[model samples]
Target: MLLVVNIGNSNIRFGVFEGDECVNSWVMNTKPYKTEDELYSQFKIAFKNYDIDINRIKDIAVGSVVPHLTYPVRKSLQRLHNIKTTLVSKNTPTELTFMSPQMGTDLYANAYYAFKKYEGTKIVVDFGTALTLTCVDKNGEIKGVVIAPGVITSLKSLIGSTAQLSDIEMRTPKQTLGKDTEECMQSGVIFGFLSMVEGLIDRINKELKEETYVIATGGTGHIFAPLTSKIKIYDRLHTIKGLRELYITQKKEGLQ
Candidate 1:
């Protein structure tokens, strides 16, 4: 069994995988001041619900985008779980086209397994603290990716900079055209972000000369997938899934 963790800015996602199948998974906020004891106790309870033992997990794999939480997580695994874990690094084996050191750990994991499993040319759009557009060639190599402000980030900036613009919760807009202030803000942030994604994908297809399969994963992925045509929605836990797949691949090849 392998324990896979993907730590993002806002949340920490964890999964227990037996080979390629995920057995249990859960998520918690990425509080910067969280003590090792707090995290360990929470993880222990999460595991206990599914009758999973931290001791039984053979290999541990982690991918972290939050630098502050990484050390504590590593220490927790080392001290409490007694498992030597491998942090996904730039130098790790991947199919990306760029230099290893330049890629973010989040994009690295998603682009790797997405291209491998889906095949052909593909794009993985992650809607997190930022919107990440990662491209893969027909040969399943990470061609490149673009990162931009997230929907909420844009909203916050607009609200902060303007007096009339009021902050609103993220949700699907009732109609593209809004008649009120709240509705208008929702449209601009939500539908506007969808348009941005579609436009970028269109440009990538035109330049690359290949019809790429667009896979959406993140907290807001499901909300936006229906608003657009021909988009596929996968669980936001894709990065964690990819980490497990890569770990298994390395183990089978005697690379781990």
Candidate 2:
């Protein structure tokens, strides 16, 4: 089994792939102070819950967006699997063109997977800590990336910053015209993002002079996926799957 870890700003996602099939996955809230033992315990608990032995995991692949938690995660994986843990980056073999060093590793995973898995000009919308819009042409050349405030990040910022406004459920209100404060916040956050997504896609299409395949992937992807007209695919597992594919390719090339 291949263990894939996508360490994001908000959460750490773990996926266990048996051959081509991802049989198990877990999401852990990110905490910088989390010890290696704590990390191992989390993995062990997930393994036990799924009846997957720790020893069965042959290798590890890490797609990290957080730098502070990188060594800790790799160390934990090393202690558990006692095997190689590959760090995925732009350097990893992939179809998408990488030009910026500031590009997130998660974006690389999404871009490569979209170009190889879906095949063609693609726009990947990631609704995570930061909403990331990445465009890749049919020839596997990356067009650009647009970054904006993520759904939950925006929510946290609003709730944390405001004096009167409190946290509300992160769900779309039944109507765009909210009735109460809760409904109003939900409407603003949810519907506002929906509009932003579609509007941006339209602008991107105009710039590209062509339509592109759109895929949304993230913890909150399902929320915006149905509401947005541009998104055709919603798969939360996209990042981990890309990590798995990257590992396989890198291993073949003896980069691991």
- Best by lDDT, which number? 2
The all-Cα superposition gives candidate 2 an RMSD in Å to the true structure of 1.3
Error of 2 at 96 (Å): 2.7
> Which run of 10 residues does model 1 get worst, by summed lDDT?
91-100
Go through the candidates in order and give the C-alpha RMSD of each one to the true structure.
Answer: 2.2, 1.3
Clash count, candidate 2: 0
TM-score versus the correct structure, for each prediction: 0.89, 0.96
- Local lDDT at 22 for model 1: 85
Candidate 1: stretches off by over 4 Å? 49-51, 162-166, 252-256
Cα deviation of 241, candidate 2, in Å? 1.1
1-256: candidate 1 lDDT, tens digit per residue: 8889998887788888876788888888786558878877877777787788767888788888877788888788777678777777545665556644677788877888786778688889998879998887767667789899987677889999997888787877779898988888888888889999999999998888878888888778878888877476656677787777666656665665
Model 2: colliding residue pairs: none
**Residue range 50-153, candidate 2, lDDT tens digits:** 88888888888998877888998899889878886888777887655767878888888888888788866899999999999998887778889999999988
